[model samples]
Target: MTELQDTGLRRRADDAAPSITDLIDEETVQSIAQEAWSALVGEDEFLVPLPGDLPEDAVSSWVDVRGPWNGTVVITTGRSTAEQLSRELLKEHAPPVLDEEDIEDGLGELANVVGGNVKAVLPGPSALGLPVVGDAPVAGPDTCRVDLLWRGQSLTISVQGTAGALLDQ
Candidate 1:
């Protein structure tokens, strides 16, 4: 191959970080969240594909995925909704009154479950990081986000590529 052609190929290879939109879609993300909610929260629970106003005090949980498509799978909702979700997730095992740690752990677990499933469908040989609770990482231009309502409360799930990764692309 000519030197110019080889240089072009190398540049293309170096700028090949995959976008989340290319790997997944809103419907797929909602389906994943629905399945997770049904299994973890309750079989009767449903996630309505309708957006509602998120309360001012919102909390976020996420898990980082490292691979050809590096990004985070994040879930954000109001604190009250998160607490309700925690109660539902714990069900019979939930304490009479949950503390902050319990709430965070529950949200984090949900993120982990959804993140694991998201990783499975992405390019092979990826690593999923442990769940985190707090403000979510900034999302880049290439993101697939699903907005839904669970029990009339707003919730969102986002598969977003890291800013740095997208910048490289």
Candidate 2:
């Protein structure tokens, strides 16, 4: 008869997953956003910490991270603000008539930059998914969200875990 002894390498199904707070905080997120804005949006653009209510027509863009920590980095702002950002991103190349595709592309790029930075602070060897624009994903229990204002416009960034894993909370 073969004897088996426990090596304690296995993890429980509900093993506590690492939270965003454990890896990074809102200040780091804001710093990353600021850098992205300065480089991509404009040289003088800055993000303020003052919180404001998001408009009913708010739009969001996000990128998913899969690794030791799994979640999404989402950026949300009003539609008009998105348009303004898109214009800034395109700068002199912006068309007179801003289009939906332009706004999404700009927002997606912002999310990618911020998401890539956020991923860097996490456990590492993580893969970032292509950006997606739409409603923000449902926040998990360990989600870490940050609110910011840009040119008096309300905007937010969130890092949220998987929905199924949220139930473990």
Candidate 3:
């Protein structure tokens, strides 16, 4: 695990995308189910120390953002949360319950939404890969993260770049 500052990702005057810190703060950092907070939590409250890591569970998803520089955005959830969310996401599709397959899709979709939005900020020339299931750690190169809290749960937003690029650019 490394901090972005250590990687020293400086933006040249000609660069279009903002620095990793700025990118995370302005784009990826957000409350999970913010719109539904009121309905679920009954007060539309934002989680404290919000913006935490989104851990991997039985069901989780992610999206990829690419451009002149390559990086990734990951979203994960706890296994229990996956089961609960799976019920909602697959109840109808499976006649009142979600199987492993349904949960997988839900996980992927969550990652996709978050990942896609982030990738859009970068130049269109790059490519973002599909989301996977596992507790992958993101901490290397130019990376920034926001820890989010929702009813005691944490959703981590990790952005890693400089993963592979100009070794000394």
TM-score of model 2 (CA atoms):
0.82
How well is each residue in 99-163 modelled by candidate 3, as lDDT tens digits?
76766666666666566656554533556777766666353453655566656777555666664
Clashing pairs in 2: none
Model 3 reaches what TM-score against the true structure? 0.61
Per-prediction TM-score to the true structure, in the order listed: 0.83, 0.82, 0.61
Task: Identify the leading candidate in terms of TM-score.
Answer: 1
Candidate 3 stretches with Cα past 4 Å from truth are: 1-18, 26-28, 31-60, 90-94, 137-142, 163-169
- Specify the highest-lDDT model's number: 1
How well is each residue in 1-169 modelled by candidate 2, as lDDT tens digits?
0122457777577687545565567777888899899998888998999899999999999998887667889999999999999999999999999889999899999999999998887654888999999977664543767889999999999877754322222
Q: Write down the lDDT of every candidate, Cα atoms only.
A: 0.83, 0.82, 0.54
Model 3: per-residue Cα lDDT at residue 165: 35
lDDT comparison, 2 vs 3, better candidate: 2
Candidate 1 local lDDT, 1-169, one digit each (tens): 0011233444356566655555577888888889999899999999999988889999999999887677889999999999999999999999999999999999999999999988887655788999999976675553778889999999999887754333331
Report the poorest 10 consecutive residues by lDDT, candidate 3.
Answer: 32-41
